[model samples]
Target: MILPFFVYGTLRPGERNHDLFLRGRTLGEEPGRLRGVTLYEGPGYPYAVEEPDGAVSGELVTALPEAYPGLLTALDRLEEYVPGDPRNLYERVVKEVVRDADRAVVRAWVYVAAPAVAARLRARGTPVGGGEWRERR
Candidate 1:
């Protein structure tokens, strides 16, 4: 069975990795919001953290499990995803993102920056909004 993932960052719209990573093979795309999370812009990508009244807007895409590994690698390059390394530009985690008010329980990856990284960007005067821009909706 294929997995459904919700993407809210570079893979959304005009982001750098949009065309390269999500150009074709868009099985399903929808403008949906994930509740109880705060989205933060770290530098190049955005990260979502658990927040009581916050959420992140993005697209829910369904992909084949076999093709997921390569896709993840591509996303890693664009977001600089690194495991066990907080210095990495972006990090991925399995989360539940809502789409069309329907819950799809799947292992979807999201790009997130460390708190320090987000703080630096915020200090520099860039803030990631809770509402995602260029989402599938």
Candidate 2:
């Protein structure tokens, strides 16, 4: 089955990790936006946290059915998301993402900062205004 991902950080197309993990594994990609989330600068990457009136910019990637298992595995490792792990750095969840081209909303998997981590980060993290990770410092 084909799976869709909403990627805002390194896994977005043209980003370093995208070339390494998603370039040939994806069936297609397009700009997407997730509402009620904000982007924050992490040590070397970025993280998304919930916010009342925010919209995070990203890419919606359709995983190739044959390559999806491996691709998803690699992504989980990269994001430090272990299924059922309470200490996971990120948690993969289904969220509604709006396609940039047609503004169509679709459910997609997205890695988001865990609740406690998000609260701490929100307390002091550098917010990327407009929720575009690539455009921030």
Write model 1 residue lDDT over 15-77, tens digit each, in one string. Answer: 776677776656666766677666765455566655568777888776545667777667677
lDDT of 2 by residue, 1-137 (tens): 34599999988877889899887888899999999888998988999998878889999999889889998899999998998898987899999999999989999999999988899888988899889998986
Any residue pairs clashing in model 2, and if so which? none
Which TM-score value belongs to model 1?
Answer: 0.72
Cα deviation of 113 in candidate 2 (Å)?
A: 0.4
Q: What's every prediction's RMSD, in angstroms? A: 3.8, 1.2
Q: Which structure among the candidates has the greatest lDDT?
A: 2
Model 2, runs deviating above 4 Å: none
lDDT at residue 77 of model 2 (Cα atoms): 92
Candidate 1 global Cα RMSD: 3.8
How many clashing pairs does model 2 include? 0
TM-score: which candidate is best?
2
